[model samples]
Target: MTPDDERFDAKTTVLIETVGHHVQEEETDWFPKVRDALGRKELQEIGARMRDVRATAPHRPEHPGSLRAADALLG
Candidate 1:
């Protein structure tokens, strides 16, 4: 494999590990703290605000080759 291939593999491994750690922390610690702090009505309001933001957000253009590359990787 090329040096670029090796670097990409390393970066992908780091990204997966970092995301896994963050997800675990959110599930085990942060989420519980948030649930305890925010009442149901407040949580519902926050969700509504998030939906509004998502509805109004502008679309971002993807790199020309990225979708094909991603499909190839997953295919």
Candidate 2:
């Protein structure tokens, strides 16, 4: 849908708000529990692996609209 479309804008707003809430809860509540469960050593290992994977990830989107879609979902 076009950026000017009301329906698209409404959906985008809702999606962004929902994602913000999820991130807040994850940071304040879930992440601590997960960190305790995973422990520092395992978390460090995961972080290193993630850094390695991210180094290989595409910096730019592959298609015309992919960047916008990725921003909406990943931001």
Candidate 3:
């Protein structure tokens, strides 16, 4: 099986919902223009950016006041 299948486990329903939302974003704001304009290299760059964001995503909820108190607690 693929890594995506393993990462998004049965209990992680929210991840599926989040992917649906991202698909909607692409449909509304990106796919039409991108389908015509962007090349494979540009698409690769976008994928790389998304990977970087996922790698450094915030794991813990940040409190309102402190800037550094509740930073990304992820590994």
Candidate 4:
């Protein structure tokens, strides 16, 4: 591969690994702590509220901040 292609592959690997780690940490660590703190009844209520919000929420983010962050990282 060309140097540019190799650089892109490395960057993609880092981005994917970072996202995977964040998801794993959030699910395996943070979510359990939140569940323990909030309990099931509260979580169920929150889940219902979340479902309602998700039904109406825009599929894409409304804010440009996320794009800016990604650009800052990748550009």
Question: TM per model?
Answer: 0.68, 0.67, 0.38, 0.63
Least accurate stretch of 10 residues (summed lDDT) in model 3?
A: 66-75
Residue-wise lDDT of candidate 3 within 1-75, one digit each (tens)? 355887557637777889999999999889988967989898887777667765555565563523333243221
Candidate 1 has an lDDT of: 0.75
lDDT of 1 by residue, 1-73 (tens): 4648858888888889999999999999999999999999998987776676555444553656655544543
Global lDDT of model 4: 0.75
Model 1 regions more than 4 Å off: 1-5, 58-75
Q: Note each model's CA RMSD in angstroms.
A: 10.3, 6.7, 10.3, 8.0
Supply the TM-score for candidate 3. 0.38
Higher-scoring candidate on TM-score, 1 or 2: 1
Per-residue alpha-carbon lDDT of model 2 for 7-73, expressed as tens digits? Answer: 9989999999999999999999999999889978988987786676565555677756666554543
45 Cα displacement, candidate 1 (Å):
0.5
lDDT of 3 at 3: 50
lDDT score of residue 10 within candidate 1: 89
Off by over 4 Å in 4: 1-8, 62-75
Which one wins on lDDT? 2
Candidate 3 has which clashing residue pairs, if any?
none
